[model samples]
Target: MTDLESADRLTEARVALAEAMALHEQGDLVAAERRYRAALAQDYRPADVLPLLAGLLGRLSRPEDALHAWDQLLAIEPDHAVALHEKGLTLHWLDRTEEAIASLERACALDPDNATALGNLGVVLADAHRNLEALRTFRRALALQPDNLHLRHQVRRLGSGAVPFWHIPMMNDAPRNDAFEAAIKAAIGVAGPEARVLDIGAGSGLLSLMAARAGARKVVACEMEPMIAEMAQQIVAQNGYAARITVHAKPSTELAVGAELDAPADILVSEILSSDLLTEKVLDTFEDAHRRLLAPDALVIPRAASAMGCLVASENLAGYAFVGDVSGFDLSAFTAFAPQRLPIHGTMTGWQRLSGDVELVRLDLTQKKHDATLARLSVPVTASGRAIGIVQWMHIDLWDGVTFDNHPDGYHDGGWLQVLHSFPEPIDVVAGEVLDIAAGHDRITLILWPLPRAAD
Candidate 1:
């Protein structure tokens, strides 16, 4: 090409670049994008032009176009931190999570000291439900900018989101801890010091630590929640049981015989029971452990758990289960939507028992499998009142002679709360009468229904 023609092309490209910058500053995004593209077509310093074009595209609400612009810039300057970071943001906006994470991760790696890039990476990780990785990324950003309130908030939010609120209170419950420790000690005693133990749902690493303290040589524990699992590992290390306990941040179902465990565990200790017993999938967890993680004759802590309760009649308790007559209106139909089971602080909640304590259902944890069960229970009435529901608590039979019951009368301020399994509707009965009720579990839930007098 002639020198004059080349010079004229260079002048035209510089003018396009200058016009694009001016249009971008004036908020004329469409015109700015046109000018930026014109400059790029003329090959006028693309490394600089691409970012401005991409930023303009993002401002114009064209995330896909912005991503293409960023990609073009990345193809030219692969290590361009700004291009990588903005590409990550655009990908996230487009709901392409995995790619966004990869882009943001690259940005952070290229610019290790960039707090904004690190924070953005954390946000993408969190959006993808990789909360543990997000928490770690936030912590890294926090380390760089120690006084960043947003980063601190992200850390706290992720940590809380990963762990349940009841965990701390459950940990502080001395009675529950003692019962579990007694069970762990007994299992270790029976299996000897060399016993291999597996603890599922290792909250705070307490159960595994108990096993370690009981002289179990190899204790493997798994917690599904990553934050809680990490905390458990820290607690285990803090309590000097790190050498004995190996905590995996995974569910027991994900654990394998040759990987997480050297061999089948001699004892299986898990406390994943919810207030109502089945909500946490305790049966499924135990069944999986028995099938894949434990020996055929492994000693299972809480070998049996029984749902114990008595018929209850309480004005305060009834208010929670059923409602009616609001502002002289019959809101009784709304009662159909009332909670089937209400959690009640047994000692603090005022209630009267219409019948003596009766065992509603008992779960044998040692069994390899369980089917849904329903049985007829006839409760002999001792007092007369409107029976709102059966206020029930758990009676757990741990290792030989180690049993714990959160009985509504005496057990209070513990991890377990007595659950009021409400009836389909209120029933009135006289003293010295038998109220036949269908009581059992459908594997995943407790089945409690009041039967008709004729059926009884």
Candidate 2:
């Protein structure tokens, strides 16, 4: 065709595409699909029209066609950000996560400030279980658009919920903190207040600053969570311990003994145990520290931790424990995926214990390694009721005299929550009978299992 004829055909194509979109807005998806394909046949860059066409196909549940259109567009415009973004989303819907991440990452890199690209990248990363990097990406998007509620929710959800309220008081638990302080003080005494110290998982930089307060010449602490680590660094300065403490933004694994520190640490103080213990990988962190970082006989804070619990029950909690059919139909099948462990506000959520507190899992931190083990324990019921499960907490035995824990009975309003290790279902029980439970830790997570009630 002549150039004039070619231009006329292009104008006609654009008009036809516009009419097709109007039809689409009028809910005539069939006509829109036809026009979109017609426009594609005109030898135009498919990438220009493919996004809308693919979106329409996806809306119609024709994912196969949508995928084909996107793949074609990608071939034409390899770095097309929209095409990459849409393709990644489609791939994710098709359950191809790794490829989706790669596509989304490419899209984000191509358009660094593209909020949609950043948010999509974050979502894809999170789906792939790369939670840390996902969080960073989400924050970057938020920095561009702070008012984004979706981004805000993702951040909150990714944080695994705010640290339970009782966690702080529990961390400050005198018995726990004093034990560690005593151990720390003793370590500093021998190290002559000049021994360099390394504190990993510096929640509040409390330990490193404590060492400095105790006269250590230098104490370095590392916290992986950026916000927390930054806060620690500031707190050190505000508390007049800045000169003595250095806060590093990293997990202990990221800290090289010689590079991040002058030499092997003379003493190591770290507290990163989750309520169940080891869930925070405290064992792994300490093992790595000892394997290559700490000197022999270096003081390790929280020499031990124990997961304690009581078979608990409350009418208020039964709703969370057992889900029976409304009219005796078998709706129980839906409850199979019920949470094995639930975090409840011990102070805010009113619940009564049907069984006395029992020591379940005890983690000896002094040990270098651990293997999972199951042991039988007979717990006596303290009150009569339907037993839902065991409400568990931790007791961290820190250096010398410091201690920290939310031992449900007395701990309230801190950064940790008493974990309700909900049973698979509820069990009716009477007072004076022993509730059998299985409890231990694989050096990572506290294990609590409700055993079958003996023949009722």
Candidate 3:
């Protein structure tokens, strides 16, 4: 072809490209797509034209066509950050999280300072529940733009998450705190404050401080929770007990005998017992501490604990424990798997004892073997009402005769919520008859089984 013919072809392509842009500006999308494609057919800057056309196709709800356009562009510029980021966002929208994270990560590596890419990476990481890493990335972004309101909100959001309702009630429990404090003082008094004291599960560093106040020369405290440990360290310093207390923010399981505990401790004080008893792995922690960390006959602060409970019924709590019907579906069958041990706010929620607080289960934490045992307990009914089941709770023995308990009768608030050991069904009874029931614990939980009543 002559030069004139080539010039004519070039002129036609440029005119078509201009028409596409004009049509796109005028809201004639179909016409714009047609003109754009016609120009592309004549080879008019395919790299620039393709991305715009693909985006328009996407906006027009034609993902399949848009995918083809993007695929072609990616084939040419494999590491193009824009293409990778957009494609990853599209994949994420499609719920293809695995591929989306990979693509977005690649885009981020290619363009490190890309705020959009970093922000998207943080979002996808959060969606995948990688909270720690997501937190780190968010912090990085905030450092880049400290005044960003959205990032600040995200920081606040995660910080306020998991606001446990039981925490406040537990914190304000005066009786529980008093009991623990007394136990700590008793321990320090017995072992002598000059003894190498090891306080495991240093909650708020309260016990450790008590030891320091009692004049302990060296106090080594380990907190299983990082946040709590940090707070405890602060409290220890604030109270002038920092010289005596060295708080390790880690589980007792992770603490090395000779490393974390400088020397074999003469006293091991820990408050890791769950309301029911063994759920906190107190047995495991104590066994390890006793076996490796403590010297022979080291006074275990909570030398022993007994989970004491009684048989009772409450109309108010029955609703939470059993559901006969929900959304027109018979959910009574769910009662079969209903929690044997239910946590109730004894200090807060409305619940009345149907029977006197009977000793249903007694766990002697001092016993060497804590397998499982059942005993016939004849509980005298103090108040006459329908007995549903045994509502079990704890009576802790910190030292010889030194104790703390949230006895359902009076103890209220502090970290622990009362455990309700719901029975299979309700039993009608009156005052003055001995309600025979199996009451005791397997060290981990309180057992309450109904038995034939003994004639009073």
Candidate 4:
């Protein structure tokens, strides 16, 4: 073709591109997309035109079309950050999570300073239940835009979402902390300043710090949650205990004698007991530590833990434990699926003792082995009322006389809440009657059930 003919074609393409921009500015998405596509067909600056077209299609809720446009742009400029970011978003909208994460990750890598891309990547990772990765990504974005409240909120949200909600309150429990510290200090004092101290589930490195403050020269802490573990390391450094403490982001089962620890720990300090006692796999963790991570004569903090509670009647708690008639319908059968145990703030929840507090089960943490056991418990009723279940709490036997219990009577605002071990159904009892109960531990949880009363 002659120069004049080529020039005319180029002029027509430029006009189409200009019209597309004008239409896009005016919110004429359909018209804008047509002109944009027309410019691309004429081979007029396809790189710039494709992104505009794709974004417009996405606005029109045409993800498939938008994906195709993004693909076309990527083919021209494979490392285009904007194209990759938008494509990742489109893929996420299409429910292709893995692909979306890959694209968003590439975009973030290519444009390291793009906080929006990093935030979007975090969102995709979170949706995939990869919370640790999501948290790390948000942290990176927050570092880049330190004052961004959204990024800060995302960081806190993901960090908290990855761990339990009780951690903060648990940290604030001064009595619990004091008990553990006393035990740790006593254990360290007995083991000597150079003793190797190991803390399993070292939340916020609090106990390890306590051990360090108590003159423990060497402390190895393990926390399974990576985010918490990272923070623990930071806290250790912040408190100038980094030289004395090393935090590993691993479960106790994964720790080795010479790897995470120089030798079997001379003092084992772990606080993994759940509200009901063993739901946090304290038995498995302690057993594993005994088998692989501790010295044969290691001083174990909280040498024993007991599940304790009393037979109780509570009109307020019964609502949480049972279901019967609801809005003119017999919904009592639904009670079969009610929560076996309900956690309640001891002093806040209204309840009256039907019987004195009884030791439901006791675990000798220093013992090397634990087997699941269920036995008969005959609870003598002291009050005439309908007993719903046992109001269970914990009594932790730390070093020497260092003990802590969240008894419903006086314990308040502690990390540990009292748990109500609801019976299958409410049992009516007399003041002098003996209520038979089957109470035990299935390794990881407390098992409390009302046995059928013998013919009275």
Choose the strongest candidate by TM-score. 4
Model 1, 252-283: lDDT tens digits are 99999999999999999999988888889888
lDDT: worst 10-residue window of model 2? 159-168
Task: Score residue 214 of candidate 1 by CA lDDT.
Answer: 84
User: What is the TM-score ranking, best to worst?
Assistant: 4, 1, 3, 2
**For residues 1-456, could you state the per-residue lDDT of candidate 2 as single tens digits?**
999999988987887788778988999998999998878888665766888899999999987789889999889889988899998999988989999899998998899989978998899888887777888899999999999999998887886432445556856666566666777888788777878899988877888877898889889899887656766888999999888899998888888876888888888887677766667887788788887778777766767878888887776766666677768687787678777777786443777778766788777766666678789888888788877888888787765556667776676665567788787778777898777777776666666777765452
Q: lDDT (0-100) at residue 322 of candidate 3? A: 71
TM-scores of all candidate predictions against the true structure: 0.88, 0.67, 0.74, 0.95
lDDT of each: 0.90, 0.80, 0.75, 0.91
Clashes of 3: 6
Q: lDDT: which is higher, 1 or 3?
A: 1
Candidate with better TM-score, 2 vs 4: 4
User: Using lDDT as the measure, which candidate wins?
Assistant: 4
lDDT per residue for candidate 4 within 1-456, as digits (tens), equals: 999998998998899999999999999999988888788887999898898899999999999999999999999999999999999999999999999999999999999999999999999999998888998899899999999999899988888776786788899999999999998888877889999999999989999999999999999999998888999999999999999999998888988987888899999999899999999999999999999988999999889999999999989999998999899999999999999989886443898899987999999999999999999999999999999999999999997778999887788677788898898899889999899899898999999989987785
Which digits, one per residue and each the tens of the lDDT, describe model 3 over residues 18-55?
99989988988899999889888888888888887888
